[model samples]
Target: MSDAATPELRRLTTYPVKSLDPQDHDSVAVEHGTLAGDREYAMVAKPPDADHDPTTASVGGQGEYVNGKRTAAVHRLRSSLDREAGVLTLREEGGDETRTFSLDDPDALNDYLSDYFDEPVSVRHEPRGGYPDDREFDGPTLVSTATLREVASWFDMTLDSARRRFRANLEVGGVPAFWEDRLFADHGEAVAFRIGDVELLGCNPCRRCVVPSRDPDTGEETPGFRETFLRERERTLPEWVDSDRFEGNFRLMVNTRISESEWGQRLSVGDGVELLGTRQL
Candidate 1:
């Protein structure tokens, strides 16, 4: 294939637990509607005790998911997962102590996280497809390497930091900035694309949340990060990008859904990506 017809998959990242540090993989299977291990485990909040401070605000409130979007405190916790061993290790930024726990022990894990957050919490596991942000299009998220570089330059941050902030599942190289925009069309439509042998339908530009505005390591918010990003994103938007699907400027990567036939397909780094055109959603 010509260079323009095939972009190389430069990286594959998955989050074993939602809103935690990402884990890189050379290859992974497409299970259910998403990458096999992506967001397979998530921490959910439990009811607060009677002594709990009522004045304090929890974005999602009790009985909801605890994530970076709900609270910046989620950023303070760093996670590393050992898939084969089924163990998870968590550490706080700027802290010397690190704790490891077995994935099989939900009570212990929940207690540790609950203590860490100073609230009642529990671990939820869904090995089928995990807790994806966009359930309608639960496939892996896609972004171009050049797009990440461009975004990093705008914030004066490193590429690695930008990657952490965006948390896309697939990164394609050998393409210009915002090249992934071509993967989607107008609203109610989808763009068909293939990576290796797997096919996916790019539904729309991902609607971003508050998580991207803070430092991935620290819970501190960046001054004017969202404002600056919105301004830059609109100014740099490619002409071919379908603006109809973009209700606002708070969008970045492409959210996609997989075909049942493509389930169990293997995707690896260096896989060639090809666009197969668009269709009505």
Candidate 2:
């Protein structure tokens, strides 16, 4: 499809903290490789015995890392960030009690979270970038609603469920199911895809993790469809689709970093997307 015919930016989701409720916005500020105020802070685990700083602990391995994945109890919780006041509001979905405090107050936040989650944790902030799951704190990930709809077909639930489960920063519409996979180097020349007015590079396919199996809202464990899908021996994929970028047969979503243009710019929900020219790499 031509740039003019490309999909529209359907939605924008920002996570102030890792494994917390996402804030939906119509427009957002993008700066220094991350959405402004997105994943600005996170409650990192402080294990009793750890060599390095607990906040720097790797999440996947047996490091001093903890979040909703470590405890489903955390997923039942929701959070809201007041950037101007530097206050964070935490509440339960089906409850009335709400905790509000300064994002800088890690001690108080830690105590509250420890009491509720029954695990020692400390809150930390990243000014340049938020605490991301990617290798380096890149930026917001873009996923297509059409892709969500197709992936949902592999399960019994609705596409809305996948959206909640996948937890993409940006959801696009009016595009094919796997158009994102072909944006860069699915074949031949590498094309640079533009979001709003930004040309994206550092494209990477997000590998599957156990987090997808956990409910984003309730934090309940499911049948692990994402895990199963990755392990499938055979896949009837498209010809232009880049299978080499994926690993473990279960990869989904494209993570892009380094916007060529549109630096210090604002990306809106209704912004049109297109490809300007061939990307060198």
Candidate 3:
């Protein structure tokens, strides 16, 4: 049996494709500054050229990615990856039809997505580190399970909904609410932490976007989500949390970065977490 007082990795989730649903993992290898296969594929918007075929589109382009922050309709689409079979399954929220495509077949995948979003979009793959929100802090995000429960209780939402809303890659158990905040230090400094043999530098709290304010499945905007969350977050703010990192209350989870020395380290679900110390950022 696990000790409730001992901090340990409770869950590991990765989004093979950005803005899609998350996939759980029991173990994952750390590489290129992030977990392998995390955000390895992303849907990229295509340029507004009438003659340009989105099906033939390449990953390289000036267009931005189609993500939940930019497109609410993304919530209506569900996706799952079968890594061994190298296949991707997709389905609409309300539709009964399901579609499956080979991971190597970007043309077909792009075609389906283009129609779903009613715009030109293509799937882009970058095995090296993939696409992370913070360039410097591209390591997997960390959050305490207690924090998720507390946040869910705030809005009368479920733990799964809170997890989807935050989209953290790592979930730690046996810690108090907002305990992950201790992993970061004041501005210009960082906290060094370890999960089993893997060492990561805690950078700062992840600033949330509008995606968290919408329903995870329907994209319906929650009335006063931010307003109510801010109030609750501020009321429960711990003294150990660094105020320097809190530009506002719309932040949760600790963003981290991996050093080259920690590359290839494997993180597991039951790995114990230890806060080693602090380092200059």
Candidate 4:
């Protein structure tokens, strides 16, 4: 389909952590593009597990390595948050036993985490649910399969390949290709979301990091395909798209927030969402 045509939205998913397995659901409560359980828990490295100094480090500050680059070790341990139990479980890839720690119970969470890594590792609850309050931290991000297919088609790859690179909470199908890049707003009252303290900004195309190279399913490392996608973007898309060059194929929607107060109160999985009109600036 042409980019100008109204694209259909299909499929939605949420990853509770950076590289942990994604949970597929028919519908989800949205608090700024965050599906109910997305990114609620994260695992970090400490003294023995990592060489970095933890004394001066803030909780979750160890996510980024030296510069903006993230460490490979972050991708090595798989973690997930159990919303019902409020526990964060971590285990080595392919390891049989999983250690569960309570996110609500800080002492137990940190103690188990600290022992597991053989270093001082702590856990923090994702305030605003999974949404972060800091502007520096992009709050409540959303992406669509239409956008994924657009980038994948440009690179002569499959939609599945693009999805692996652009991990998101929801993937609406039936939306026209690349329609997500232009979705500034939604007019439907049925589809409302709100986040406390966290402002929702439509993300610009997220720069792909090496994390995509690691197979979320297998935990095996693969060569980065982001460079190929970038090369194709420069060749096919107009210069405007290239003006803000990023590694991945996803685009950002800016300056918008959903009415999330009624989300869990009214909406549930399998609830039909209709797109009335785009939100205007």
Candidate 5:
């Protein structure tokens, strides 16, 4: 593949728990829809306002799924899981103290997390479930670093990778700006994600939410991120497309799922991204 056709993976990040600190890796194993340990365990929680509308947030408990979007305080917590040992640890930033729990025990895990998050939470993991945003195992998420820098420039903010709200399993380098958006986000085009011996379908553009505006390190919200993103996208939106027909949000990434012949493959940072087809305008 030509240089433009090949994008290089720069980082592989996994979130063992949804909406917690990212676990950075030089290489990771990709399954049907997720990295091996990514979001394997998420804090099942109730709504901030369960008393008003119990049905909408009820998962047989007071509320339902809790995440950074509803509770930004989660952004303050960092998580690490020892899959082999079934141990998960949550640590606060700038503090040496840590809270450790065993996934083997459900009761204690929920109790400990409930207190720490200042909300009633039940620590839950679907042993057979791959806890990705696309529950259907549609794909893994990818965000380009070049695209990150572009967004940063729009807001006149520091180009700090840590500040990037878009959580992507694979962060890539090379390719022109917004290449992924064209191939998938804007047009929902299918492309080949090949690296080493693995193949994934660049299925769809990931939808966005308020979660990305909050800083994962401090829980502080960045203003104008959405506005800037929408403006930038408007510049690139195809004239033929109905504005409302597009699937993803103003700030979004592509979802890539493992394709046939490579159900479980190990992916490394240096993996080369080879686009198989043309990008729609």
Candidate 6:
């Protein structure tokens, strides 16, 4: 809450493989919360369930997979997304080899993934031919250190610990908590990114999931630390809707037409960012 702690810039990271793990980088390309190499591959059900509709299967959100529930198990398989080569690679932990597929060929990707998972897992393209129908993002998803600090303070933990729980693409320094709701970066110039053409919405304060409780490095679950922390500190916030559902830390810029290619063309980590003001929606 002090001005002295606000930083003008911050580090950015992307998890090329969803749920598998996040890879941090000094700077990355951001377009609608997706870094170039993030989440290009997902494990999908090979055959739809009795009432399931593959065509309309939801991509991101809670419990759209087996048993209609989302858990760390879905991401247990290790995968990586490579942008330059337009490829999605997969390998089992401690396995001898890796499997690679081109996002350009959906059929081949689907076949390979299905066989690999011993189920009907498919590779979904990123920026998937101009964003899929299920995408909940409106503009770019940004986070500031101030916001992280506030969330940490609420949870009585260090920022490093919180960062592991709420994974954000851009972790900027020198801005107020939740400033991304009102700021935008234009052509690498920091500008107030308000929700005009773009819808500015905060993610439900993220419900602490088992993923954070499970050490990504060790693959072991700690005893009730995350859930206990949430109960004691973050449970009262507006974003914390209830015991089972907490608001997501990942915010969204909705109803905007910021194209991924256009956004990619303009922004990069370390680019100058400007804060416009509080949103007026």
lDDT of each: 0.86, 0.70, 0.87, 0.48, 0.67, 0.48
What is the C-alpha lDDT profile of model 1 across 72-145, one tens digit per residue? 99999988999889899999998999999998866678788889888887777778888888878889999999
Identify the leading candidate in terms of lDDT.
Answer: 3
Residue 215 C-alpha lDDT in model 4 = 50
Residue 202 lDDT in model 4?
A: 40
Better of 1 and 6 by lDDT: 1
In the range 169-218, model 6's lDDT, one tens digit per residue, is 55666666654443422222223342212223332222234554554434
Going through the candidates in order, what is the number of backbone clashes in each? 0, 2, 0, 26, 5, 23
Residue pairs clashing in model 5 are: 46-63, 46-64, 139-256, 139-257, 140-256
Candidate 3 or 2, higher lDDT:
3
Candidate number with the higher TM-score (5 or 6): 5
- Over the stretch 1-281, how does candidate 2's per-residue lDDT look in tens digits? 53544688999888887778788999988877767877777766664333454346565554544565566776788888888888889988788999898876556777888777787666767766677777452767887887788777776658877887777888888887766776545323445666786666536666666666776778777786655565431363555655445555566777766553556878789988775655655
Ranking of all predicted structures according to lDDT, beginning with the best and ending with the worst: 3, 1, 2, 5, 4, 6
Q: What are the per-residue Cα lDDT tens digits for candidate 4 across 1-281?
A: 24444332245566675445556666556554345666655444443235433223534745321111244444446666666777667777778988886666667766765664466655444534552322332434455566667766655657886675556554545555444444332222112222222223343444445655555444456554556655665554433333232334433322234444434432233333343442332
Per-model TM-score, in order, reads: 0.92, 0.85, 0.92, 0.62, 0.81, 0.60
Residue 173 accuracy (lDDT) in model 3? 94
Order by TM-score, highest first: 3, 1, 2, 5, 4, 6
Decide which is better by TM-score, 1 or 5.
1
Candidate 1 lDDT (Cα, whole model)?
Answer: 0.86
What is the per-residue lDDT of model 3 for residues 1-281, given as tens digits with 9 covering 90 to 100? 12456899999999998889999999999989999999888787873343332224423555667898788999989999987788999999999999999977667887888988988887777788888877778999999999999999998999999999889999999888888888888889889989999999999999999998889999999899999999999999996665588789999998999998999989999999988998998
**TM-score: model 1 vs. ground truth:** 0.92
- Tens-digit lDDT track of model 5 for 101-219: 88887677677778877777775564433567775434568877877777667766665643347778887787655666644423444556576667766656667788776676777
Worst 10 residues of 3 by lDDT: 50-59
